[model samples]
Target: MSEFIVFDLEFTSWPGSLEQDWSAPGQLREIVQIGALRLNDDCSVVEEYEALVRPLANPRLSPYFTDLTGITQEDVDQRGRAPAEALGDFLGFCRGLPVLSYGNDMVVLGENVGWARARGDEVKNGFLSATFLNIRPWLNFIVPETADANVGRLWEVLNLPKPAAGREHSALFDCYSFTAALKHLHAMGHWLPTGFL
Candidate 1:
């Protein structure tokens, strides 16, 4: 059975800390948390994973980031980990399952790879750079631009049932919403083509 591994990542910040550290060419910032739901060929939820990683870079959490994601400094201080280790753990769990992320969040993943290299990780010998399923581009190709310009806003516009609101910035919450959106679109007869990366 074909399964889709839908995921969402809560980052260290909005613009992200790694953006400024261009010296870390192949590394990306730390993922504060990662949540994913594995969907069966029938689009039924088969499995799920979530983790809170300890931050390795910034000593202080940005106020804006906290406001946007609702993840407090205390939460991060208590849980975040090194970026390479977190990515390794996440990737280990994911295995060979295809990843589906919202919009340009994959760029964040790219940043992760760079950050890993900067931290002396082995991502350079790992998965290729374009190795993620970006749901935003797919949605854009199928849905009209007027529907909802922001890929992040797809949940609000599509309004998939069963994902309780108010968990917006949480990784697991976003993953659930992403799955709901895909299911809703499938039920509406929108088909995702094979071999789409």
Candidate 2:
């Protein structure tokens, strides 16, 4: 049996396009939230976890960021945990299971490992490593002629019910929507069962 996990992350972004400078500072991404759900080989929900992480490089949360994510400075102050420790805990919570998150940024996963490495966290190297599948690339490979590969667009293509307004930006909400979209695609015969739950 092949278990699979789905997850999403929210990040703090600096104002600029990746092409403008392409450096970390120029286009910084600080992980804010992570939401993950684990599924058994048969696609049944097994476990879930969510967490808020404080930015290590940039402590300040911009007004635009707060407005867009609905995560306020007060929220960060009240609940934000140290990035490294929080990431370690989240990974520990997973018990060495692989994760599936939207896109190929891998920023959050990298941070999850890097932050742990810095502190000599107990998780093994292989445990920290993950199997990352970019949803865009997966969709493009599966249906090359179509342009809409994101969850929002994929939902429309699969004729699945639309998500509530303003729900895409949240990690937890997006994770659930992404799962449904994938299921819809599978139902339409567009996606084969990968034997990965």
Candidate 3:
């Protein structure tokens, strides 16, 4: 394939959610946003895809979530698509390429899709049919210092220029930051896993 996909997701969260593993009552990691880009051998962006998804179990956005991501309840209520609908479209945009994420976002993606499927939502080109590779382990091996950095913080952690717009938690901005890191790493002659260019 001439292109590969790097994607990011923004999911529902509240105070202590990450530490608590969202085990609190009525909490689900419903994906609020999906961001991805298709890149060629040179790390140039060939295409971009983004979507806002509405959560089912908890249709409301948490105060902490809004504070962190700048994605308000209004945005989701006004623009978000249903989880299955949004993700199915995202899967179609992936075009079956090797999909990569900074962390185990694929698991979160799977969980949401699984929940939707359990609710009798038909999701074509589902998560099971998609190939997901977590780039965290390989990245840690190459740049140990960045092992603890967040996906959206990669470029800043590497001392590269900040992306033109958007902040750390937003999915699309994070994808741009990821792409920037790949470009910088490629230019520096650092070893990357095969097929990343």
Candidate 4:
């Protein structure tokens, strides 16, 4: 059976008042956490992977980022590894599987790759060629009522339990929620294999 690597990421961000435009290619947000689940064809999770990545450009976690994702400077400093190491591990874990992600994970992944390249780190070419399935459009297609639903709204619409308070933005937790939503959609007779829109 084919596997799908469903994943999420948490990244560093400045406060709204101090936020710089991330329009420039190299100025994109730095990822701090990676969380993913490997799912069988039936959508049952086969394994899980989680990592905390140290930010090279923004070593200290911003207050806004901590408040939003509950990831602190201490957490990153104590538990995080270099982005290249973390991403390398992640890519290895996801080898041979199509990736599934919510929202802008692909954009962030691309930005991270660029950041790595600029730093002279050799990122895996497999990641550059990997197929990515964005869950939003597929979810919308399957559940017309949720056509424009964001993550929270999608969870509510699917009757999936709300994430515990203060845990919404963490990568692993979000992955779990997204996976639950996908399983619920599948149970309702709308199973979508990866990249099958």
Candidate 5:
């Protein structure tokens, strides 16, 4: 069965970071978590990958970020790998498979990689060659009203039963939400976007 990947990221953010586009001093979208699923043509799970990345630029997880993502500072201190290591593992997992994300999260991934290299951290992965197809446009094409619904809210916004047991915001749970929406649209006869299958 041919497979592709769907992924999400949880990043460092402050109360006003999104509004400011994370332009505030020392506020970068350094990834804190990466959640991805590899799925076959039937939309069945083929494999799963999750990585917790220790933020370098903003080593501290703000209260707003923790509240939003449910990832505690202790989690990173305990299990988070350096961003370079985490990113390399994620890229290796991709293995050049076609990748899909709710938005242009690849940019954030790239920014993290770039920052790591600038800090003289070793990042040995295919990140520069990695690419992600934004599924938002196609999803919104199916249900125009849901254009604003993120991967976190896609299930609820579609009024579909939740596909898995997990809270939104955490990257892995959000990935399931993305899959749920795709399955719903497929059941309604929409095709997986061209070139991604």
Candidate 6:
């Protein structure tokens, strides 16, 4: 059966004006966490992968970042791997499956690929070649009533059940919520693209 890799990422950010600059090569938001769920053609869970990526240029986690993501500095310091290494492992886990994500995961991933290339890390070309589909637009199309809904309002618009208490924002929880919405759409007989099947 075909597999769909649903994924999400959390990146480093500061509280105020000093936050990492997206345009600056050295100051771009470094991916801190990656959470993914592998699903069979039937949308049943097949496997899961989660990783903590250590920031290279900006190793310290800001207070606001901690409050927002609940990922403490100690968590990254003790458990995180370097971005290149973490991404390498994540790619292996994906195994060339089509990727499904929310928001700008592909954009951030492209930025990360540039970051790795600049550092002379060997990233597999296939990683860049894999299909990436953003479900937000499809979600909007499926539920025209939610055409204007953003991520924060997606749950209500999709009528997806709330996730387990206190489980939002973090990569895995976001994946779960997104996957739930997709399943709901599928059950409603909405036509997902063949790539998703």
Q: Please report, as a residue range, the 10-residue window in candidate 6 with the lowest summed lDDT.
A: 17-26
lDDT ranking of the models:
5, 3, 4, 6, 1, 2
Q: Could you estimate the TM-score for every candidate?
A: 0.79, 0.77, 0.94, 0.85, 0.95, 0.85
Q: Model 5's lDDT to the true fold?
A: 0.88
lDDT of 1: 0.67
Clashes of 1: 14
lDDT of 3 by residue, 1-197 (tens): 46788999999999999999999998889999999999887778899899999998889999999999999999999999988899889988875577889999999988988898999998777655557888889887777888889999999889999964989999999999988887887787874677543
How many Å off is the CA of 197 in candidate 4?
Answer: 10
Comparing 3 with 6 on lDDT, the higher-scoring candidate is 3
Per-residue lDDT over 44-83 for candidate 5, one digit per residue giving the tens place of the 0 to 100 score? 8889899899997789899999999999999999999989
Q: Which regions of candidate 4 deviate over 4 angstroms?
A: 17-27, 144-153, 162-166, 193-197
lDDT of 1 by residue, 75-164 (tens): 867776666766766676566667777765667766776777877877423454225666676776776651454433556667545574
Candidate 5: pairs in clash? none
Please tell me which predicted candidate would have the highest lDDT against the true structure: 5
Better TM-score candidate (4, 5)? 5
Worst 10 residues of 5 by lDDT: 123-132
The CA lDDT at 20 in model 2 is: 58
lDDT string, candidate 4, 10-107, tens digits: 88776553245555443448889999889887778899899999999868777888898888888999999888778878887878678888786878
lDDT of 6 by residue, 76-193 (tens): 9899987778887887777678888767787777778788879998776546546787876777776887666544345666777874344566888777777777777778887567
State the TM-score for model 1: 0.79
Residue 167, candidate 6: Cα error in Å is 2.0
lDDT of 4: 0.77
**Total clashes for model 4:** 0
Poorest 10 consecutive residues of model 4 by lDDT?
17-26
- Candidate 3 residues lying further than 4 Å off, grouped into runs, are 195-197
